[model samples]
Target: MSNRPSPLNDWQRHCVRRTLERGGVIAYPTEAVWGLGCDPWNEDAVMRVLALKQRPLHKGLILVAASVAQVEFLLTPLAPELRQRALAHWPGPVTCLIPDLQQQIPTWVRGRHASIAVRVSEHPVVRDLCNTAGMPLVSTSCNPAGRQPARSGWQVRRYFNDRLDWLVPGELGHERKPSRILDIRTGRRLR
Candidate 1:
């Protein structure tokens, strides 16, 4: 067995960095499956992800992060209870829809929703990539809306070889499911 410091080797990180710097879309491992991601601030990159998924822009997307600070700019003023509730389940497989501040969030990122979906990811490669990129990334499953999510780099390549600018090889976490989503304001389960 190899004793690499991470699941991603240096070459993979290099590719991830280059793709993100150029506002490109990448397929990478996530908590339960592969995910397509791009700079949240890059409209073109975000559009590419939507196009690759054959998804409608009005459907919006989730932003995954290494920490709450990565996504703080997109959130509105929150009550202490709401903030605590959100914090309680973060750094894991739970997504929460927080009130959008509107000022920092672009229409493309927010879609037609009044809130933005954000998750502090527990997946190592995901967290490292977000932290390295220095911003939250627009994240969606690496597949067409009606299809199953890509669970491996080979599957990602099959689904988006020409469409995606890069692919970061890594292993999915132990979870056999997608993240659970909740609306902070209403405490409603959205997924």
Candidate 2:
């Protein structure tokens, strides 16, 4: 294999960040698969991702962050033990479903649910993407509903073609499966 560190370079990363800032949807590598991402706070962008995935609004979406600070806004109302429990698994492949106490998250991101899923990722590209964008991204598998997730940059390109504003070049992290979902309030493992 070539020694290329990742599918993206500094310039490409910058471009992707700009695209996101402009309400563009993008494709990028995640811990277990390629993921479609957009600014979580942008309704139109999030809608595009939902439409692109052919997923229903009630299914909700995931938010991926580079650090706890990036997602701390969603954890503020949780009980200290629950917040601590969720934080203990951070910077890794774990998606925690925390109650949206303030209801500040948009309906598009939360869907019809009272909780929103959030993760603090250790994947270099994912972290870089979130940090560069200055916020967590609405992250979902890079494929239509009921289809296998894209695992490579080529697959992402083929799947979305020119529809995506950018295909962030990167490789999947070591995770062999999507992040496990945990219900923070109930202390239950969802997946």
lDDT of each: 0.84, 0.88
Q: Write the per-residue lDDT of candidate 1 for residues 10-98, one digit (tens) a residue.
A: 77778788899898998888999899999988899988888889999998999999888877665437777878778888889999988
Q: For each candidate, what TM-score against the reference?
A: 0.92, 0.93
lDDT of 2 by residue, 1-191 (tens): 12325445779878987898899999988999999999988889999999999999998999999889988888888889989988989978999998899997899999999999999998888888887888888999999888899988877877888899988876788989989999988879988
Best by TM-score: 2
RMSD of 1: 3.2
Task: In angstroms, give how far residue 103 of model 2 lies from its true place.
Answer: 0.5
- Model 1 ranges off by over 4 Å: 1-6
lDDT for 23 (candidate 2):
93
What are the RMSDs of all candidates, in order?
3.2, 3.7
- 120 Cα displacement, candidate 1 (Å): 0.2
